[model samples]
Target: MAGNTEPLSPRAKLAVTAGKAAAAVSRAAGRGSGSVIGGRVALKLDPDLLGRLAQHLDVILVSATNGKTTTTRLIAEALRAAGPVVSNALGANMPAGITSALAGGSDAKFGVIEVDEKYLAGVARDTTPKAIALLNLSRDQLDRAAETRMMAEHWREGLSGSKAVVIANADDPLVVWAASSSANVVWVAAGQAWKDDAWSCPSCGGVMQRPGDDWFCGQCGFRRPAPSWALNGDYVLDPHGSAWPIHLQLPGRANKANAATSAAVAAVFGVPPQVALERMYQVQAVAGRYDVVTFQNRELRLLLAKNPAGWLETFSLIDPPPTPVILSVNARGADGTDTSWLWDVDYTQLAGHPIFVLGDRKLDLAVRLEVAGLDFRVCETLDEAVQYAPPGRIEVIANYTAFQDLRRRVGN
Candidate 1:
């Protein structure tokens, strides 16, 4: 369902007019991509932009190391049932993106915004949301963001006094520790399949042991909180012990966990489980994730892989062996300047499979693949890469900028 994305009269109309003018200037100036510059300009004009606009409206925030964009999309898909919504549909998590998502429209009853992990506190403090969805935390950009434990600590500080009901992942130790003392938290047993970063306790710096789905810190005695919502296999188990089957167009166990968390968030607004899951089936793609595009005559299933933990999940989505794969990378502002993180990804998953490297960072990616003992050839051009890929749909895994470049080329 398309959102009736007109700006609501919740804020002074002058703020909206000024914000639109900034956006217009940005579009005329041919700034980076689209309206990001415009949004930034608007916020610069009005410091309390989102707070003034989103104070009264129903707002939901989605933040995580991965899946924030996709999960936000899923929640927005269901919240349309409530009323008109304003959301950062372009996967912008910072203030500018949230500003554009909110200031771009008026008369929206609901607002959904995807936030960056580092900026979560500011956004939460600035705007009072109805629900704040905290997904798993892990090591992201080594250059920019804080460590995972530090990220959790910042969250613990930011979320201490919020009135919004917290929907947190019980399986992630970092999330449990971060949301430890929140006044009202609704835990969801959304699966945390990747645990490389969760090896130690965030509180006492002790060993974190995972004993069959539940994690316990041996030293601090912190354990996985009892989840009120769980995804048991193909069924979503309610707090009342009844199970409902939820089918989503998105593939992989990670997406299933995402859907379960999104359903829980939707449930906070009295949205039924059946309705939430059904609407999610319409969102096959989130900002370019899970987007199947015919790029250069080759159908490509695109998934973004920015760091080690995210790479683990993306690798799981690709069909193993004999399925041709395209690996793309770039070191742009959105993507961290440091390409050293490339070594952290478990590229061995593609061992013995036909892999083709593409991107401006193709040479660096090629070196990484070579070190992993994988034999691969380089496809210098997009058409050449598609030709190298096996017939039919090829899995294209890329980082931030490369994926955006590919998406733009595909005319999204």
Candidate 2:
């Protein structure tokens, strides 16, 4: 059925938008195919139609640099444990994507969505979610996003005067500042080794200093407090390969942060800590982000590295015994607007591992890998790259667009 089938009235458009919001409200529903907003399709729907569509459904905008997808999925899962929920559990985080996900469901009380920071204000103005869960902010996709400040400003402006409960990461300076400014704020603290030490205070241009767990501007003395619900202990991996102690589903410390954010957001819905943690261990990673599949009796791990930050975070997870790795970089407009952020990703960690480069931009990755002075075998065909990569232990790191192509080539 066409997800957007509605009458031409303003109220009809709003109902359609709310229906899309419903699709996102539950994890059981996959992404509805009707709302494709990335390129030319974004122009398919009229602005008035789109604005009216946003008027329906209880939208929950979950925005962050890293943990958005996992957190969004986890929040939906936790809410489901309590009762029925609708969510855009799929990786579609934009307006059309959220709309598409929202179109499939009939029964849903809540709509949990992972919104793109660039479009957060617009979506907020349209849908007006019940709660805005602001995860930590960091540098990502500099070309399209411009800078962290721009996105932060847009987020602050989009959420102005909304009664949506503000769930924020208190450890992050940008998030803490934004959350503290809101009267209806619930702070979530998390222990992350990599704090925003590099960014200076936006006000007074003074050095940003960590006076305790809390951070303040050395120049302006603007302070942001710690999170109320913080994960302060050591993280132990689950033996079964799930994200935690259940199955080995999610890998890497970054996933742990994702898990922590999920737990905190779940708590906001009154889901018990034990239930949240249990659900977290039970859920599997969504298709492209750190998904592992077996092909030809060999282990192939597919990790999505969209931006420099995501790439670096994945790199940190490679506690290597020198395995063969295949890295693909594709900038299909759906994946991103620019692919130049590869320079910011630290490929040095993979120096010990033999690398195979593929994709439409194979040469770019090869040149970058070579500039880093690492050894790699470059191939134009994904099959050839898979054949030439590590025989028994293989790791494939791909951006969004290249994943399906690689999966098909490797026969998984």
lDDT of each: 0.83, 0.66
Cα lDDT, model 1, residue 270? 84
lDDT of 1 at 269: 88
User: Which structure among the candidates has the greatest lDDT?
Assistant: 1
Q: In model 1, which range of ten residues has the least summed lDDT?
A: 1-10
The deviation in Å at residue 138 for candidate 2 is 2.9
RMSD of 1: 3.1
**Model 2 over residues 17-105: C-alpha lDDT tens digits?**
55444444443344323345321133244444444334454456798877788778867876677666767776677777766555444
Candidate 2 whole-model C-alpha lDDT, 0 to 1: 0.66
Cα error, residue 131 of model 1, in Å, equals 0.9
